[model samples]
Target chain A: MGIREKPTRMDQVQSWRADFPVEYLYTTGVAGERFAKTLRERGMLAATRCQRCGVTYLPPRIYCQRCFADLSESWVEVPLQGVIHTYTVVPVRATGEPSQSLEVIAYIRIDGTEGGILGRVAVSPEAVYIGMAVEGVLAPPAERRGAVTDIRYFKPILS
Target chain B: MARKRESSPQNPHDVGRVMREIPERPRGTPLKDQDIREGKVSLIAWKPHLEYRWDSGVAISRFLLGLKEGKILGVRCHSCGRTVTPPRAFCEWCFRPVDEWVELKDTGTVNTFSICYVTWDMKPLEIPQIPAVIEIDGTHPRVGFLHLLGGIGEKDVEAIRRRVRVGMRVQAVWKSPAERVGAITDILYFQPLE
Candidate 1:
C-alpha cells in the first residue's frame, strides 16, 4: 500500500539507450516543382502572385494564405537577386560537434517578392550583415538539378 | 405576416455568393515514388539520429533486477488478489498500490501466438520468428506479456504453425550468466516445455 523499495543507486536502475534510424522522402509540391524547374532550366527565380492581395510568394505556393486566392496560374519570374534579411553564424556542425570553421546561414529576401528563402552566404561571417545586397550564384547549366541547391550559394553583390 | 427584408450587404440572412469555375480534372503535377527513384522529379532525403534513454521505475526496476538473476518477479495486489508479472506499482482495477513482491516461476502457457515473417523494420527474415503472449505461472489467468517463441528449429511457416498452439506449456530460455542484463532481453526467448 506504500513505497516498499526503489533503486537508489543509478547503476541499479535499468535504462536503455537507442537511436531512431529513420529515413524520409520530401516531395517538391506543384509550385515547388515549377520553381525548381525554372531555376534549373533558365537560371531565374520564379514566384506566384495573389491577384486579390497583390502579395508575391517566392518558393511559390498554390494558394494565398492571406486572401485565399488560387496562385497556380499567377507564376512570374522575379529578379535573380536579393537582400540579406537575417543571418546566423554557426560555430558547430549539425551533428552537435565543434567545427574547425564557422558557417553563415541566412534568409535572403528575393527582389520583388514578399517572402524569402533560406540560403548559405558564401562570404565570411564578419562580412555578412542585414540589408546587404547579394546575388544568387547558380551551378553551370549542364550540371543543374531541379533543386534549391541548383543555386549553389549567394555571394556579396555591388548595389 | 413577416415584412420583406431588403437585400443589403449587412443583412444576416442573405449569404454572399460568388461564381467559381471548377476544373474538369484536379490540378498540380503528381509523381509516383518510382518517378522520384528514377530522377524524374526532385525529392529531399533526410536521415536523422534521435537517441533516447528509458528508466524502468519501481516495480519494473525490481522485475528487471530479478530477471538479471535468472528469476521472474511479480507484484500482488492485496485488494484484487491478482499477481501480475512484468510488474507494475499500482493495481489497475483497485487503483491501489501493490502489497507484496512475488517471485514467479520462469514458466507460462502460450495464450496466443503469431508467425512473424518480417523483422521490426519490415525486412524479410530468413527464419520466421514466433511471438506470443505467455501467461506466466503464479499470475492470474489470461494475465500475460508478449515474448518471442523459439526452439522450433523449422524454417517452414506451416511446420512451425503446426507445432505451436494455444495453451501449450512454455519455459523462459535465459541467456548465460555472463550475458545477463537487467532487461527483458536477458531471457532470449520462451521455448516449448514438456
Candidate 2:
C-alpha cells in the first residue's frame, strides 16, 4: 500500500488565467449627421426648435424632449456668439495612449438660447473664465463630412 | 384715444373685441421640392469626423513589479508632505511631482472593506470574494491598498475590521512563479499573521 502527495495549494491559485474580450463600436444617426454637415458648409450654427413650445436645442434632435412632439422640420439658425459658462483644465491622460496632452473642455451658453453646448475650449487653460465670449469656427467646407469636430472648437473672440 | 358709449344690447363675448385693417403682400411663395431636397442633402454632406488620443503612462506597470516581489510601495508628495499608497506620480492636492519612493511593511491592518459579490464588470462573481482596504504599516497612517483577504469567512466580512483591528498583522500570499504577471491580481490575497 502507498500514499500519493497532492500538489501545493499555491499551484491552484497560479493556474487561474483567462482571456477577456473587450471591443467597442459606436455609430451616430442621420439627424446628428445632418447637423454636423450644416456647421461645416456655411460656418453656421443650426439648432432644433420645438414647433409646439419654441424651445431650441444646440445639439439638434428629431423629437422635442419637453413637448414630446416630432421636431423633424422645426430647425433654426443660431448666431455663433456665446458666453463661457464653466470650464476645466484636464492635465492627465485618461487612456494609456501616448498622444494625449493637457487640454481644456468648456461649456458655452449661446446668446438667446436657453441651454448650452459642451466642447473643447480653444484657449489657454490658464486664461479662461465663466463670462468670456466665444465664437464657433467650422473647418473648411471641402474638408467637412459630418461630425462634431467639424467645428474645430469654440474660440474666445476678442471684441 | 376715444371712449365709446354703450348703444346696443350687451353681448357676453363682445367685451374685449376690437377691429383693425390689414394689408397683404402681392404673393407668398412656397419652397419647391428641389430647394428642400437641396437643403437636406447639403446638410448631410457636411458632417465631420472627430479623433483624439490620450496616454496614461507606465506608472501602474512599475507598481505591479514591486508587488510581485512581496514589497509594498508608496509615492511621496514633497509639496503636501505626505505619502500615498497605490503610488501616484503626481500629488492630486498640490499638483506637483511625487518623486520620493517609500517601501511600506507587508503587514497592515484593515481600515475598511467590502465583500464583493460581483465581478469587476458588475456580473455575479464565482466563489464570492472579499475585497479589503488594507492600511499598510509604517508608510502613512491613512494609506491603504485594495486587496482580497483570506483566512476569514464571507459572513465575517462585517466583523473583519473589528477582528483585524487598525494595527493587526497581515502578510501577502503570493501566487506561483509561472503565474507572475505585472498586475495587481498577482497576489492571491493577504492572510492574517498567526
Candidate 3:
C-alpha cells in the first residue's frame, strides 16, 4: 500500500532507451482551405476576418472564438511584406544538440494584416532586430507545396 | 375553468419556440477529391512527428534486464498457480499480486499468425512478414505475446509458408549480447524449430 524508501540510486533507477516512431496527418478545415489554396496558387498570404468582431486571423480559423460565428469563406490576401514583431536566436536544435550555426526565428506582421506569422529568418542573427522590415522569400513556383514551407523563409528588406 | 399562471424560470416554455425559429445548421462547400487533385482548391498536407518516451517501470524493468541476459521471464501467481509471460505485476484472474518471478524457456508454440503483404504505412512488401502470437513453454498454455515467425519448413522444398500453422514449436532468435539493448527488440523474432 505504501512505497518503501530507496536504498540507493542504482536500486531505485533503471532506464531503457527506445525510439518509437509515430506520424500523423492534420487537416486544416474550411478556413484553412481558402488560405492554403491562395498560398499555393498565387504565392500570397491570406487570412480570415470575423465580420462581427473585426478580428483577422493569419493562420485562419473557421469560426470566431468570441462570437462563435462561422467564418466559412471570409478570405483576404494581405501584402507579403511586414516588420518583425519579435525574434529569437537559438544555436541549439530541438534535441538540445549544438547546431552548426545560429537559427533566427521571427514573427513578421505583414503590411495589411493585424496578426503575424512565425517563421524562420534567413538573415544573420546579428542583423535581426525588433521592428526590422522583412519580406517573404517563396520557393520556385513549380516546387511550391500548399504549406507554410512554400514560403522558404523571410529575409531583411534593405533600403 | 382553471387558468394557467406564468411558467417558472426553471421550466421555460419559450425554449422550444426559440429552437423552432432558428435556421438549420449549414454545411461548408465540401472540397471534392478532384478539387485537390486539379489544384481547383488549395489543399495543404502536413506530416507531424510525435516523439515520446515511456518508462517501463518496476516489473517490466526487471523483465527487460532478464532479456538482456538471453532469458525470458514471467510473473507467477501462486494463488492460481499460473505463470504469465510478457510479465505483469498483478494477476487479473486471481485479483492479487504475483508471488514470484519465473524464468520461462526461449522456445514457444505459435497460437495464431498472419502473413502480411504490406508494411504498416500500407506500402507493398516483396516478401510477406509473418507475425504471430507465441505462447512460451513454461508459462500458461494460452498466454502469449505477439511476435514474428521465421525459419519455417526447409529450403529444399520451400514449403515454410504452406506448413507454418498454429501449435508449431519455435524459439527466440536473440540478437548478440553486444547489440542486445534492454528492450523487447533484444529478441529479434521467433523461429520455427521443427
Candidate 4:
C-alpha cells in the first residue's frame, strides 16, 4: 500500500495601491480662441467655410485646404433639423469603476448639412434607424456656455 | 635549404611524452515519459498596460475654454456659408479656406441622440447618462453636436423627445465656477427649454 501527503497553502492574498499619473498639454491659436468666446457669450454655433469650394463646416476652421486661401469672417446661421445616419447600443462596464446597463449611440446628419455628428441616441435602441429626422436641445440660460456640451443629446423630432 | 636531424630531450619521463587523458562524459538520467510530462515548471504572470497623450488642436482648446465659460461656439466658412460647432479652424468641405466666426443660438432641436449607460471609456457609468445630437439654430444647413441631456427621467424618453424637438428651445447646464476647466467637462449637460 502507498501513502499520500496532503498539499499545504503557500501564499496569502494581499492588496496594494499604486499611483497612476497622467499629464496633458494643449495650445489654441488666436482665431480659435475668439471663435469659442463668441459662442460662449452669444450662444451660437460657428464654422469655417472654404473660399474656393464653398463648403461650410459645423466647427469653424481658419485655413482652407482646397484653395489654400485665407478665409474671411462671414458668419452664417444654420437650421436645427437633420436626419439619422447610423446608431448602436453599448452595454458594458469598466474595471474598478461605476456600472451601467444598455446605452444608445448614433450618428446624426443635420438638415441641409453635408457632414454628420456622433453622440448618444435618445430613442430606444430598437427604434433607431437611418434617415430619421432629429434636432438639438440647448441647455438653460444659467448653464449656457460656448461649448459642445451646451447642446445636450439630440432627441427624435416628432413634429 | 639545410636539413637537420631530430633529437630527443634529456629527461626520460617528460610530461610531453605521456598521452593526455580525456574528461569523462556526463551521464544521462533515465525517467518515464509520464513522469516528465506531469512535472511542474515555474512561470511568471504578466499583465498588459498602455498609455497615450492626446493632442487637441488650438481650435479645440478654445472650444473647451468656451465651454468652461458656459458657451457653445462654432466656426464659419466665409466662402461657403457653413457653420461648425465645436469650432474648427478649417473647413472639410469644398476644400476651401474658412475664415469666419459665427455664434449659434442656444435654442435648437434634437437631430438625434442616445441614452448612454456607459462612460467615454466604453464602460458602464454609475448612472445612466443621456447623450444627444443637437443642431444649433440660425446656422446654414443644419449644425449639430453630441452632448449629455437632462430635465428628463431615464424612463421618460418620449417626454424628452417632446421637450427637445427638432426646433424646441434648449439650453446648456454648466458646472460650478470652481470646477470650471477649459474642457468639455465644463458643461455638465444640456437641459430642456422651460
Candidate 5:
C-alpha cells in the first residue's frame, strides 16, 4: 500500500537527537596510576616532584614540563587542603538544561603542588571567594575506588 | 633449516610433520576474556555517560519534518540534474548547491541489504534486524539510504537471506503520526511490497 502524503509546511525547524554511543575505559597512566592508588589506600593527597628541576606537580605529571625531564616516583602525601584559583557559576546542567540551582565549579591550587586540579565547591556563592582555603572531603574508605570521584566534593575550611 | 618432529618412546613411529610452505612465526600470548573476568588482570572498567544534540541543518530539518508528516522527501539537485534521498543541501556529484526539493514515493526496490543479527550497540537480537538500503521509487536510480527491512517471507535469517533479493520492491511502513518523532526512526521499518 503505497499511499502518498501531501506536503504540510516548509518553515518548521526541528532537532533530532541520539546519545553518544560510547563506553570509555581510560588507563590512568604512569603518574595517575600511583596517585590514584595512594588516594584509594590512604585518604591523603599526593604529588610528584621533578627530580631535575625540583618543581612539584599535583595530580602528578609523568614528566616535568619546565625542565623537560622525567619525574621521580617520590610521592609526598600532602594535607587535604587547597586554595581557590578560579571559579564559575555554571547556570546549566551537563545535559544543557537550565539548572534548577547554581553549581559552582572551581580550580583549586592544591597544597605542596605547583599546579592544581578542578573540583566542585559545595558552598553558597556569598561564602565563596578567590584564594579561599578549602579541604577535599573524601568518601568513606570502604566506598573509595581510586577515582577522582573518591573525593566527593570540596568544602570550605574555616580560615 | 630442517624441521624436527623427533619421536619419543611413546610414538617411536617414523613421524614427519607436514609443512604448508609458509614462514615459521613466533607466537605472542594474548589476553582472553577469561583473564579479565577472573580478575587475573588489573584493569579499570567504566561506562561513560554522554549526551549530544545534533543540529538538523536546512535539508535534514525539512527531511525530518516530512517524516513526521508521513512523507519521504529528497532534495532535487538541479546542478547534477538528479534527485537524491536523505536530502543533501549540496550536490556531491556536481560540487554545487542544491535549491530544489521533492517528495519521493514510499515503494522502492531493495538495492542491497544484510540480515543484521545485532543491535546498533553491538548487542545480539533474539530475532534478527534486517537493515537494507531501499531505493526510493520516485527518485533517481540507486538513490537510497540505510534503513531496516522487516516482514520478509518469514522473520528468520534463513527466510530473509534466501527470500530478500536485490531489486525486490519495498514500501515504507510509517509509525502512527502520534508516535512519529522528527527523526529517522519515524518510519518503524520498510517492508517488502508483495
Candidate 6:
C-alpha cells in the first residue's frame, strides 16, 4: 500500500453512473430457418433427422451432435402433440419479482423425436405431471412469426 | 527442384479426394440480412442493459474536485520531476507514489488535433467536431489529455481543419460554476487563444 495523503471527507470522493449498450443481430441457421418458416407458414413443427445416427433434432440443427453428420437435407414435420418430460412451477417473474399467477414451465418431449423443446404449459401446477400428453396451441397462421413463441403454449390433449 | 515431385502420384489422392467429396455433399442454406428483413428467414434479437458506478480514486478524486472549483490540477513526481495533468497517483515510469499537487493554467497548446465527421454513436454529424490533445501550460511537453476544441466559428469540416494546427495556443472554456459537477466535462472545451 502506498501510504499517502488521503482525503478525509467522503465529499472529496467522486463517482459516476454509466450504462453500456450493445446491439447485435443473429441469424437462424439453415435447418433452424426451415423449421421456423415451416412452423410459421403451415402451423406445423419441423425437425431434422441424421441419416447416419438416426437421431432427430428439434429446433433443427444442420449437423448431428453425436456423429457430426450433415442433416441439412433431412428435414421432417413433427407432430404438434408431445409429452411433458419435466416441469417446474415458477411463482415469480424472470426478474425474481412475485407474480399474480404461477406458470408451469416445462420441457416437452415431442413425439417421434428424442430431443425436446421448452414451453409453458397451460395447466394448474398441481394438475400438471410428467408424461402428461400435451398438444401445442399455435397462434393463427397469419399471426405467426418465425419464432418459438408462435406456439403460444402447451395444453392437455383431449382424450 | 526440377527432379523432385511434391508428392508421389500414388498418395496424391489424400487431399484431392476430400476436396472433391466436399462439393457433392449437401451444404447449409445461406441467407443474408436482406432475407431476414424480407421475412424470408428468422432471427433472434436481444439487448441486455447494464448499469454501473465508477469511483474516481485518490488522485483523480482531487483533480475532479479542482475542476468543480474552476481550476485545473496536476500531480508532480519528485523522483522524475515531470508534472502530469489528468493526474494519476503513481509515477508509471518510476513506480513511485506521487502526492504533490500543482495548479496549472487553463490554457494549453494543441499537440495534435482531429476533425470527427461522426458522433461517438457513428451517426453523421452536420458540423464536424474538433478534438485535440492539448498539452496544458506548466506541464511537461507532450504530456496532455484529449479534449474537444471549439469557438473556431466555422461549421464546414475542411475550413475547421485548415484553421486548427498543432502547437496552436488554446484556453479552456469552463462551464458556469453552477453547471459544473466535479467532472472533466466541467471545462466545456478548449478555444484557440487569439
Indicate which candidate wins on TM-score.
1
Expressed as tens digits, the lDDT of each residue in A1-159 for candidate 1 is 343666678877787788888889888887877888898889998899988898898779989989688888999997679899999999998789998889889999999999888988888987889999999898999988878888888999965
TM-score, every prediction: 0.86, 0.40, 0.62, 0.38, 0.66, 0.82
By summed lDDT, the worst window of 10 consecutive residues in model 4 chain B runs over: B39-48
- lDDT tens digits, residue span A100-127, model 6: 8999999999998978889999999989
The Cα error of candidate 2 at residue A141, in Å, is 1.7
Candidate 2: list runs displaced more than 4 Å. A1-11, A14-27, A96-101, B1-194
**Candidate chain B TM-scores, in order:** 0.84, 0.59, 0.78, 0.63, 0.79, 0.83
Each model's fnat?
Answer: 0.71, 0.00, 0.25, 0.00, 0.53, 0.75
* lDDT tens readout by residue for model 4, A37-122: 55556655555667468877555556566666665464554554578788777775545454375766777776544555676667
lDDT of each: 0.86, 0.68, 0.79, 0.61, 0.79, 0.87
Interface residue Cα RMSD of candidate 3 after superposition: 4.7
DockQ of structure 3: 0.20
Clash pairs, candidate 5, are none
Off by over 4 Å in 5: A1-11, A21-27, A66-68, A72-74, A81-106, A118-145, A149-159, B1-58, B61-71, B95-99, B153-158, B174-186
Considering DockQ, which of the candidate structures 2 and 4 is the better prediction for this target? 2
Model 2 in CAPRI terms: which quality?
incorrect
Candidate 1 lDDT (Cα, 0 to 1):
0.86
Candidate 5, A1-159: lDDT as tens digits: 011223345556666556776776555666766777788889877787876687788878767788677665566777678999999988899879999888889999988788787898998887789999999999999998887888888999984
Best of the candidates, DockQ: 1
Can you list the residue pairs that collide in candidate 1? Answer: none
B110-144 per-residue lDDT for model 1 (tens digits): 99999888978999988888889999999998999
Question: Model 4: runs farther than 4 Å from truth?
Answer: A1-159, B1-46, B118-126, B156-167
| CA lDDT, candidate 1, residue A111 | 90
Sorted by TM-score (best first), the order is 1, 6, 5, 3, 2, 4
Clashes of each: 0, 10, 1, 82, 0, 0
What class would a CAPRI assessor give candidate 3's docking? incorrect
